[model samples]
Target: MTPESAALPGAMHPTDQSTQGCTANGEMILVVEDDVELLELLGTLLKSAGYQVAMAKDGMTALESVTRGGVQPDLILADFNLPGAINGLQMITQLRMALHRSMPAIILTGDISRLTSRDVAFEHCVQLNKPAKLKEVTFVIASLLAQQRNAKNDSERPGQFAPGIARSSIIFVVDRDDLFRHTIRGVLESHGYAVHDYATSEAFLADYAPGPPACLLIDAHLPGMEGVELLHQLRKNGDDLPAVVISGSNEVSIAVDAMKAGASDFIEKPFGRSEMLQSIARALEHSQDANKKLAWMQEATHCIDSLTLRQRQVMDMVLAGFASKHIAAQLGISQRTVENHRAAVMTRTHSKSIPALARVALAADLRV
Candidate 1:
């Protein structure tokens, strides 16, 4: 359908009362779908709500547009079933690599049963079934964009510094068995780890927030929303909290599913204290690595944001391995002038050498 024809009229429009509460403020959205009609409908809806929309018919086109720096979208809305080998999740991953940062995304699919925990494991990404209500879609988009804005603001706040070290050493245990919870809590507490035990997954999720160096010991079989599903939900919400799954039966399929759901490790029932401790140690180590990468990404983003337009151009050329003379010629300036801008770029980025400057640019995903 044509863009004009796809536009909803008056009361049926996105700007109507149903979606008025979640109006967009010029945030760019990249919509990818193989269906032309659906794609046009999404573009029109988003544009009507004040978002700048970019359309892609398939995953490859979306990747090419993002990597080529054609559009820097704030959020991506992609259909899971694409024509090519690249799916919605893979396209999001490629875009994240190009930007040198995680971007918010939502996967729209008709068959919710076909989706596995691994498909939506990306940070700041969620999946919605097809035929979703327009109000629901608008609310999710607004929430994700608002989260991004809040995170950026928090990073820029004064007196705020990235915590290179882990926070509190707390372990949360979620199991239906009272005896097991008591025994595990005692064992963990004896080993110098603070343990909080909950009777069900619901209780744990209600009290849980992302904080500190922590791990979750969840039973594989729970009354509702099994352990692996809980882990998947946490990961989808951008929570990097390490988790270990414990099951009564040593089923290989269960272990594999838990791992796919972002669990650090899986342990069979009747585990020893030493075994549990080892799993916790490994999970904490993984958390530390994630924290370090997050810090580096944040620092690189800040440094890149501090550069002026000319300085950014110079930095990009340097990263591209262009010599000062060639860069000056391309930019229509003298070689000495190029060197001056180059020096300023290095100083502002706090990069001592060409290689260091290149690393910063790469980490920030700046395209030349």
Candidate 2:
């Protein structure tokens, strides 16, 4: 069906009005699984939720569907194990490479123990144990789409800063395949992390700007820069980004190399869901620490000259927890003027709130 024909009866065409949700007309989701019954069930559930759905029996077919644009699924739900050469993860690496755009994704599997520590570390991706929970699936799909919409908007408006742990956190998936990328993207977003996906090391390096990424999950066997090389490049560029490497290969040498190149950890493919989550948590924690240090360094580097005398006074007072009105009176200035100075302090310090500014001020050798 043409894009218009795919619209729900009596519903606005996805092409017409972009809705507030991640999907405008309806988000397109590609369901890839060897099991016919599960695929049908997933399709039905997604359609009921107002999503445009497509299906593929295996990894290669899923890639073809994405390539043909028969349905450019905004997300993919894939089975980890598949019939032939390309498994779910392999396919994910492929499709994502073909289409540089990031799509949210989730992996459905029977065994959670199959995944390794490294596979679980990828950000904005999730895996569901077999005999899936429908509610969990529903929530995952909705959450990922919402994150995608927010990420797209944030990327477009680079200067707008939002305050919150969610806003500061980001997940990056460096997989070559599209279906796998989608599956993982679905999983991570479901767990509540903003995700940015790229198919290849080249693509990721070229397009990914330094921002709010909390951690990176990368496939070891990428087209251009292997995970080790990519890890090195990121560090060389002064991006102390934490990463976890997942590989189908079980070579000790490879694992060692990945770690040496800066991967926080390594996992062999076909890993369990629980393992993936645990690994990701570890990497995120590491990334968070690194980011905090970086933020402090940057704040300290800002020139004293950037702030007006009034701004400095306001910042110190705010850090001390004085109310705006109180600061105004103490400074013998109008509350509005004090508020303006407070805003300037935040702008200059890149602080989200008065407390955040105060913490930065305390860390830095503030002139005031």
Off by over 4 Å in 2: 1-25, 114-117, 153-368
Overall lDDT per candidate, in order of appearance: 0.72, 0.67
What lDDT tens digits, residue by residue, belong to model 1 across residues 223-274?
Answer: 9889999999998999978888888775545765676677767776555444
C-alpha RMSD between model 2 and the true structure = 15.7
TM-score to true structure, per model: 0.42, 0.42
Prediction 1 global C-alpha lDDT: 0.72
Candidate 2 at 75: error in angstroms? 0.6
Error of 1 at 171 (Å): 20
